[model samples]
Target: MDLTVIWAFIIAFAVFAYVVMDGFDLGIGILFPTFAAGRERDRAMNSIAPVWDGNETWLVLGGGGLFAAFPLAYAVILPATYPLIIAMLLGLVFRGVAFEYRWRDPAHQKFWDMAFTGGSFVAALAQGMTLGALLQGIEVEGRAYAGSWWDWLTPYTLLTGLGTVAGYALLGSTWLIWKLDGEEQAHARKLAIRWGAATIVLMGAVSLYNISLNADYAARWLTAPEIYWVAPVPILTGIVAISMLRAILKERNSKPFWLGIALFFLGMSGLGVTIWPYAVPEALTIWDAAAPERSQIFMLVGVALTLPLIIGYTAWAYWVFRGKVADEGYH
Candidate 1:
């Protein structure tokens, strides 16, 4: 196999890992407001506390992969989406501080918790904006950004931003159902049901809008017979989402969280498949943007050795932090 093809798969897998791992934590942060107080909110936070930092590793790997494998795409995307990137970084900072600070200052815990929620909302929004902007397609000339700054601030992009929030909130609520028990668990279930419904609506609207705007949707999604196999993912996602709603109503939290994750990942898979061969939507083909084969081969050698180590450490960390959080003071 060609090194370019191998690197392409690596990059794709890295991005997917980031989306699946950090996704739920982001969602849990977004879910902060609903639980309100006592064991419920704490349980929600505790559910992710064990692996939150490790989950973010995928982001680092994904970004690094892009910079190393598709330098041109990185150059264009970073500058064009600088504002959103800044917002995301800032949100992460606030979120990080909130996690520790909120626990330390028992006197003002509420404010810090709110800060965490707000930070999550901002980060999720920035990511969604970036995604929407990518879907809208940027102006690329000789591997550079040629579009105006205002081009990224469109209404459609804004809608995508909100969609991200809805999605994350849905993930968070589902997570709470899985890890928490008693009254907290029940509240989380309720929140999940409400937000899950809202997410389905928003996601559907975005899909319709994107299809309407992009004339190539038919070619990508509905053109050849191969698309028949692809169509079932979204259909299955809808079915699982409906089942999650029923599970929540029945006060079944654990399974709903995993199912919610499956639904979320299904949506992501649809987007990835729909935009295959194009790293930046319609802007650039993966082949055109891939790094040299020699460099990719070298990178592959490193990934082969390092990937297992990272995965092992991640599993260990989660195992150490497993089980519901007690009333013990936050360290």
Candidate 2:
């Protein structure tokens, strides 16, 4: 494979990793209100507290990878999705502030907690909408957006927004299942069961809608000889979904979260496989979008050193925070 292709794969994997990692924390934030009591909520928060900041590092690396490997795609998509980007950034700020503020004032903590959860909800939703809009493809004339604000707010985009929320909720609930015990674990399992069911339904609907609107994707994925093997991708996704269902029903202590990871990875695989050549779907091919080769080579050397450092630090943080949140709680 070409170096450009290798770099593209690197960027895509970094993004997918971010989605799988930080994605759950965002989901946890969105589900914060569902936990009822303050102690349980605090434990839930503590479960992710150590790694949440580190999780966002992947997002930065993903964007940096895009700038280095696919500068053109980055420039165009970022500007087109500026409004949604602002919303996500504001949500990030709100979440960070809530994280800090909620711990400081026992009296006003609830407000901060709610702000964190709501901020997470907004961020996740905006990102989903941005993805949906991107899937619909930008009206790009040369290198500029040729559409209005309303174009970014369509029914399909709305469906995607909800679907992403559901996906994150599933991830969050499963994380709780893994990290908590006793009543906390039970509550998370219940949430996981409900959210998992809801996610499957919502995502199934989105898939059907995508197919109905653009049968071409199905045709490309199902009919083309070169892509005929791709059918197994969805088949595997269904198997993972079914496995999740069985795990949730059985209420396994140690396996549900792993199953959730499987589900997320399978879904991501379906997406990455289907959109292999296109960085922005039909709008821009990876080669067309890539920065200059010299730039990629230069950046790769820096990235090689930095990425491992980030990973090491993140692993250390998780290690330090390992084990269940204690009874004494967030202090």
Maximum-lDDT candidate? 2
Question: Candidate 1 residues 1-331, lDDT tens each?
Answer: 8776677777777777776677778888888776668666766777787788788888888889889988878888888899999999899888989988877887999999888988888999999999889888888987788988767888889989998888888887777677667777777777787888988888888887777768776566666686687888878988988888888787774778777777777877777776777877778888788888778888889999988998899889977876665655345
| Tens-digit lDDT track of model 2 for 163-269 | 88888888888888878889999888888888899888887877777666665566766576846677776788788888987887787765777777777777767
TM-score of every prediction relative to native? 0.94, 0.95
Per candidate, the number of residue pairs that clash is: 2, 0
Q: List where candidate 2 sits over 4 angstroms from the true fold.
A: none
Kindly report which residue stretches of model 1 are placed more than 4 angstroms away from their true locations once superposed.
none
Residue 171's lDDT within candidate 1 is 80
Q: Report the C-alpha displacement of residue 27, candidate 1, in angstroms.
A: 2.0
Q: What is the C-alpha RMSD of each candidate to the true structure, in Å?
A: 1.8, 1.6
TM-score of 1: 0.94
Task: Provide the lowest-lDDT 10-residue window in model 1.
Answer: 322-331
